[model samples]
Target: MIKIFEKRKIWYGISLAIMLIGLGFAIAFKGLNFGIDFKGGTILTFNMGEQVNQDKVQEVEKVISDFTKKYSARETNNTEIELIIQTGAIETEQVKELKTKVKEEFNLGDDYLVQEENISGSIGSELTRKAFIASILSCIAIAIYIAVRFEFEFGVAAIVALIHDLLITLSVYAILRIRINSPFIAAVMTILGYSMNDTIVIFDRIRENKKKLGKVETGELINSSISQTMRRSIYTSLSTLLTIMMMVILVPGIRELTVPLIIGIITGTYSSIFIASPIWATLRDKKDKKNPKAQYGKKKKTSEA
Candidate 1:
């Protein structure tokens, strides 16, 4: 009974406002921190014969800092240290030397483990290209599937809603200053699949309602379809979100993966119900108005005109 579609303009406006503000921040701040997955970096994992102390780690960090400056002969920003340390990448020789220094300082044995890895710029660029291509292909495939299952207009509306969700998610990351990396790409892809599923459900209901309520106005039919499926959509999205929230709060290393996922699922669900369905309803109404068959019922009048 609640006429959500009737207030489509207001909802659309709100979505646009949030998206624009996010866009502004992204453009100004350069969209959070792009990690080595896109910019190339080293990945190192160190294994210790004994548990390392914080002071030892700090001392090792300082030594690495001095060594990098002398080796590269470049003065880098302090912020770069945070990025580099998290990546855990250093040269093999450097790792061996660091192990020797640490062993002498802590009197450890050769059982200590140290690993080093380095990623080049070309490889990082290739990864960025692949991620972009995957996202585009996903959108195209979903558009084709929606069109085949419902109508072209419905498909277009779904794609638009999808874009809206992606942009909004990106904006949130930018505003919140989350680190962008491989996990972020995975989250984006997962959200894309999720939002598509939600859109398909609403589109299916619209198709069913259209066949059953032939005499109902297109807008009213859309409203009815959404109303019928609202509970299911909310319940499903909420349950998923709750699990993600738990992981983000309880887990230490996986916060990066879970945070973006939580944001994507919430916004994706909202867009499917509020943005995609309403736009499809409006388009369907316009199409029906132009079709004479859709305007008149199948029953014949008894010489009425």
Candidate 2:
């Protein structure tokens, strides 16, 4: 028995430390690196007319760097040798000159400048708001589902674990200055669901054990439940992480999604095993303290024979 509940403070402390580090970074730094999808900017697409190699990417980045400090360049998935550049709003003549410079630099024809469009900061603001709302709503829905399926305490603990996973992921993003875009929001939503599923598995095990072992101490029951499910959780997270890592290595275009998946899986598994169960045990312990006879695992007979 790992005595997980007995060492609750250690787990909680570790999580608190991670969260604080991320918070400290966020405070010391200006904020997260919001990509054009969230911060809003102009999208410029160019067709090199040939496959864009790393050298080509570096050249495009150099050209873009001359225009705006806040910009991102990536090779698009289009079959037509596309490169997309996003940057803060620049003047009309500047856009024209940029096109000319790109054309001259690469010997590209006039039509090499495939598309140009501006995204308003207001629209980006709207997206940020919607993303926040969606996350809150999803958390609420998950809590409701877990509460109905198990107990309210379990639901709350699971939410805490999910939030912990979210904070850890965002911390990594902020620390690394990763771009937060539409794909990031989608990835976050996926992380929340994935994390919640791991938590539910452990909670399910705890609930089952509570019934089968009617007189076990709360901490012992929690430890046993976690121990029983820990292997399964580890295996599941590892398999998912391996798949995502392979995707991240093999598919460059989907790094935005795969990177977060990797972070979420590790944190999710940790929280499910170390955080959520301890929290539930603590909550149950508190409830037991409030009413001595209503201790966890103590079955009450309806009538004495």
**For candidate 1, which ten residues in a row score worst on lDDT?**
72-81
Q: How far does residue 131 in candidate 1 sit from its true spot (Å)?
A: 1.0
Model 1 off-target regions past 4 Å? 47-114, 289-305
User: What's the CA RMSD for each of the models?
Assistant: 6.1, 3.1
**TM-score (C-alpha) between model 1 and the true structure:** 0.78
Candidate 2 residue-wise lDDT at 160:
87
Backbone clash numbers for all candidates listed: 2, 0
> lDDT tens digits, residues 160-247, model 2?
8888889988888877878787888888899898888888888888889988898777878888998898888899888888889999
For candidate 1, give the lDDT: 0.73
Error of 1 at 82 (Å): 9.6
Runs in model 2 lying further than 4 Å from the true structure: 77-89, 298-305
